[model samples]
Target: MEINGVEIKDTYAEGFGIKVTRILVTAATEELAKIAATEATGYGTSVIGCPAEAGIDCFVPAEHTPDGRPGYAIMICQGGKKALDHELMERIGMCVLTAPTTAAFNLLESEDTLKTGNKLKFFGDGFEKECFIDGRKVHSIPIMSGDFLVESEFGYKDGVAGGNFFILAKDQMTGVKAAQAAVEAISKIESVITPFPGGMVASGSKVGSNKYSKFLNASTNEKMCVTLKDEVESDIRADADGVFEIVIDGVDEESVRSAMKSGIEAACAVDGVLEISAGNFDGKLGAYIINLHELF
Candidate 1:
């Protein structure tokens, strides 16, 4: 398939199942809310080495927030319930709770609930008080500035992870530019996280190693490397000089598909972008496979 004269390869992106939760961080102003949200999501790009994958979903105006203050919606993705709970406690306690005039609230309306500030209320040293805001249970913890408000529980749901695509270009600079455009486009999307540094992954990996240890978790995709085109079994064209990938984790298949489609469209509109493709470990690695050709 061709989009704006850019070739779309007949490949699919592999995605696995994960757990996702949404947290709303509110403050006196939008700037403060964003500061807390950005700090909470720091160092949370990919699960490869990070504890959790997270990103800012969007900014919520004061009217839409629980505390009648500006807020930001953030999503955190993890492998299981225990991991998600641990990550949320650590992130919110250290980041959002410490920020000035900041408060955290659970945005999910599901019947299922996970302990959020319920565990952190101990910092109040037996002085914490239970309160109700808009009929929702909230814990007011005493702090230096004033009372720190946090929700007792948060909501979580099953999600699809590891939705990825590749951008092959004529040169490294060209590939980087395409990836930047793709990231910018996907950043506006809701319920999805790119899970990589600046929303781009230069070290695309395959399942295992061709040599060395058999127990290796992952190895480089030499076939897609422009420098190793002649030495390895390559999928890169003779004119292609570099390739970069974008991996997305979303609440569902539809969200992931929408993110991928928008990202691909933005990347294809750039010059020197040769082809758009995706990464997949056959049909065995993930729960869902998003086909690139069918995205448009």
Candidate 2:
């Protein structure tokens, strides 16, 4: 199948079931809110080596925010409950608490709970105070700057991760441009995040290492390597000189599919993009299989 003359590979992107939490970081302005959200979600791309995968969902205007300020929503994901909890605690404590004029709140609205401010409040050394805002418990912890307002609990729920697709181009520059366009498109979608640096991955990986090493859990995806076209059973085309990937984690299958569709369409609209493909583990990796064909 082809979308806008860009070939859609006859394959599916494998996904995984993971625990997710949505956090809202609000600030006096959108800029500060973005800084806090970006910081909190930094270094969180793949769960392979990182503790979690996170990305900015979108911007929330002052009228929509809890504190009547600009805010940014981000989703943090981990393999399990404990891991997700740990990620939230570390990220919120270090990132949000340190940002100027910023406050954190729960955005998921799920019954399942994760301790966010409740854990970070201790940073106040018993001087922390509590209050109720619109029926939700919020804590104000004193800091060197003043006080940091944080929601007591963060919402937690099961989410889908590892939703990804590859952009094959005739050259590296073209591939990068296409990937950027795709990322921009996906960023507009809600309840999902690209996670990776600049929302693009130049070094994609496969399931396991070819040379089994104690330090390496996964190795490079040789099939997507243009240089290895003649070296291994490559999936790269003869004319393809570059390959970049965009991986997404969403609150649900629908959100993932929606983002993927927008990304693929945007990528296909770019010039020099030869084809669009996805990474899958023969349907063994996870229960969700986002078929690229079905998307179009």
Candidate 3:
């Protein structure tokens, strides 16, 4: 199939079930809130190496925020519950708590809970106190910047991760432009986050290593490598010179599917976009299969 003259490859993105939690970081101003959110989500592009996969989900207005201040909603995802809990304490304690005029709150409601604030409140020693913000229970931990409030019990739920698509272009510059357009379009969708830098991955990886099988879990995707096109069995179109992969994580499978479709359409609208494909391990690595052709 084709979209705007761009070929839609008959492949699917392999996605797996994971744990997800959304936190709201509010501050005196929008800029401050963004800083806290950015810091908390930093170095969280992929779960392969990073302890967590996180990104800013959306911005919340003052009226909607618990402290009547502007805030950014961020999602932190992990492959398991313990990892998510550990990452929540580390990120929120080190990043959000350190930020000026910032407070963290739970943005999602789920039956499963993580004692995030309970663990971090110890930073206050004996001075920590239980408090309520906007009718929600929280921990008021005194800090040099007055007090840092964090939700007592952060809610967590199962989420979908690794939903991705690749944009094949005539050159690196064109691939970047198309990927940027796709990321911008995906940003409009709610309950989804693209954790990569600028929401695109230039170095796509395949499962396992050809040589260092014990030390390396993955290696460069040679099929997407223009230089290795002739040497390796290439997946890129004959005219394509570069490829960019955009990976998406969402609250559920439907949101991931929607983001993939939206990103694909946006990429196809860009000039020199040769094809849209996806990464997968023959549907063995994940529970969800997001077919690129089915998206259209």
Candidate 4:
């Protein structure tokens, strides 16, 4: 349970079953790949808050990319077919389609027919063109820099969503540093991504509301805030003064557990890190149960 001097909790992180699609964005260079990846994953934190939960999954070296440029893989998570389709349409249309010298492709190779590029083709205002590459249909949308290519549709598979961990530290700097280290670790792992803001969310939420409106499904956990430590149920360690949550989405429970284990190990190496814990709804989410201790 001890990673260096930091304590890893014996608790588990729970995740529910959701449909996931992998999006490959390729650019002319690493800088463009990073920018496109950031944009594609931007504005995507929570399903209710944003349209989907997405992040950069990995980077492909130039030799591996289609255009012989650096590329990034991103995972988009949604609850169902309709949500996934709709969100992908919006995100691809707005983010990937707008980026310069970039192309999008479906990570999944499936026979099931879907229409991702068919929906986004509207952005071309009828001037769009299509091509077949390796038997996959790709659409090209004219932009300022050049044409942006995207696959017709991405493959859909059931995946684990909402795998998360909290990094409690003695201060904001420590917490942020820990988070950065964790992101670096997670980025190296395949099939997992941190979708929250800056790969971390400070405002952790709990199930249901206390005094809020009936329509609200969840609200912020004020108790987790350092300022409210005196008035709320304190779960943070005594030496910890700040907290940040890392929310991960993965293709499966095992992938999530591996990513979490790697992330926690990297995060605990930093100074001022007190403990590593996870967010869960007990066993409500039956599909993915990531036991932190077992994972590490």
Candidate 5:
């Protein structure tokens, strides 16, 4: 398949099921809200070295926020319930709660469960109080600047993780430009995040190890590397001289597919972009293999 002169591989992207939690961060100003939300979602690219994958979900204007200030919604995904809870406590407490004039709230609601506010209340050091509104519990933690309010419990749902695509270009600048275009395209879509470094990972991995005895999680796709183009399989090799990968995580297969399709379309419109591709295992994650052609 060709999109605006760029080749689109007829392959699929594989992903797995993960638990996701959304939190709302409000602040006195829009800049503060952006800072708090970005900080809370920082360092959460991939689950390999990080506990979860997170990013700014959306921005809400003052009229939509409780404090009449700008706010942002953030989503964090973990492998399981335990990891999700732990990450939520640490990130929200240390990042959002500590930020100036910022407050946290649960974007999700549950009937009977362990609430995030209940875990974060300890940060108040005994000055914390709880309030019930519309049957939802909110914790008020006294801070130096003001009070930080957070919801007691957050709702968790199964989400799709690791939907990805590759942008092959003739040079680093071209690759970067293509990736930027793709990011901009995907950014407009809801419920998806490009969680790699700077929302794009230059170095992508394969399924398993080819060498290195002690390396249990080493999988290198030499074909995707320009320097190793002569040393790997031709099918996976990039026709261009440079390559970059965009990894997306979303609420479901359709959301991911939509994001990927939009991103690829945007990237392919740029110059020096030769082909668009995806990363996947051989049916290992059969539950969420989004076909590229079907998406386009």
Candidate 6:
């Protein structure tokens, strides 16, 4: 298929099931809220090495927040309940809870939950208090800056992960422009996030290394690399000089499909985009085999 003169490869992106937690990080100022969110999501681009896959879903206005403060919607994704439990403690306690004038709230309505706040209230050294915020039960912990607020329980549910697409262009600048366009479009989407840095992966890698499988968990996609075009069985066209991959994780398969369609269309509108493609492990690696053609 051709979209805006750019070729769309008939392929699929492989993705597996995961647990997802959506949290509201609110603060006195928008900047502080964003800072806390960013910190909580740092080193969380991919699950291959990071403890979780996370990113800022969108910005919420003060009036829309539960505490009447500006905040950002952040999503943390893990392989299962156990890993998610550890991530929430580290990210929320060390990142959001430590930020100045910031408060964390669970946004998911899932019945399954974790007593994240109840676990962290120990930081108060036996002086923590139970409270209600806008009808939701919460815990107030005393901190050096002020009282830190966190919902008593945070909900989590099964989600989708590793849905991705590749953007091929004539040069790095063109590739970056196209990728940025895609990220901007995907940002408006709810219940989905592009976890890579700036929502774009410049150095996309495969599941494992061909030469040193035991030494590394992942290796560069040589076929997709511009520099190795001649040495390897290249995937890009002769004229294609740059390639970027965008990975989307969402609350469900439908949400991921919507994000892929929107992001691909937005990227195709940019000049010099050559083709759009996706990564897959022959349906051997993931629970979902999302076909690119099926998206449209």
The 0-to-1 C-alpha lDDT of every candidate, in the order given, reads: 0.90, 0.92, 0.92, 0.83, 0.82, 0.95
Model 6 deviation from native, Cα RMSD in Å: 0.9
lDDT of 3 by residue, 198-217 (tens): 99998899888998899999
Over all chains combined, what TM-score does candidate 1 have? 0.95
Candidate 6 lDDT tens digits, 140-254? 9998898999998999999999999999999999999999999999999998999999999988998889999999989998989999999999988999998999999999999
Which stretches of candidate 4 lie above 4 Å from their native place?
Answer: 111-113, 122-128, 141-145
Error of 2 at 72 (Å): 0.8
Q: C-alpha displacement of 29 in model 1, angstroms?
A: 2.5
Please list the Cα RMSD from the true structure of every candidate, rounded to 1 decimal place.
1.5, 1.1, 1.0, 2.1, 1.9, 0.9
Using lDDT, give the best candidate's number: 6
In the range 1-296, model 5's lDDT, one tens digit per residue, is 89898888889888888888777798889899999999989889878668789988778888877666789988899989888988888888899888999877767555424467888888889999999744557888998988888888888778889899888888888999999999989888877888876678887877657786476464667767788777767444445777899988887788888999899999989988988888888877547887788886
My TM-score estimates for the predictions, one after another, are 0.95, 0.97, 0.98, 0.91, 0.93, 0.98
Residue 226 in candidate 6 has what lDDT? 97
Model 1 agreement with the true structure over 1-296: per-residue lDDT tens digits: 89888889998999999899989999988999999999999888767668999988788899888889999999899999999999999999999989999999998777777888899899999999999987879999999988899999999999998998999998999999999999999988888878777889999988778885567767888898888999998989888897999999888899999999999999999999999989988898887989998887
| Candidate 4 global TM-score | 0.91
Q: What are the runs in model 6 whose C-alpha is more than 4 Å off?
A: none
Instruction: Give candidate 6's whole-model lDDT.
Output: 0.95
Query: If the candidates were sorted by their lDDT against the true structure, best first, what order would they fall in?
Result: 6, 3, 2, 1, 4, 5
Query: Which ranges of candidate 3 are over 4 A from the true structure?
Result: none
Residue pair clashes in candidate 5: none
Give the least accurate 10-residue stretch of model 5, judged by summed lDDT. 106-115
Better of 1 and 3 by TM-score: 3
lDDT of 2 by residue, 1-296 (tens): 99888899999999989998988999988999999999999989898888889989999899987789999999999999998898998899999999999999999988899877888889999999999876779999999888999999998888999999999999999999999999999989989999999999999998888788666889998889888999999899899998999999999999999999999999999989999999998987899989999997
Identify the runs in model 1 with alpha carbons over 4 angstroms from their true place: none
**Count of backbone clashes for each model?**
0, 0, 0, 0, 0, 0
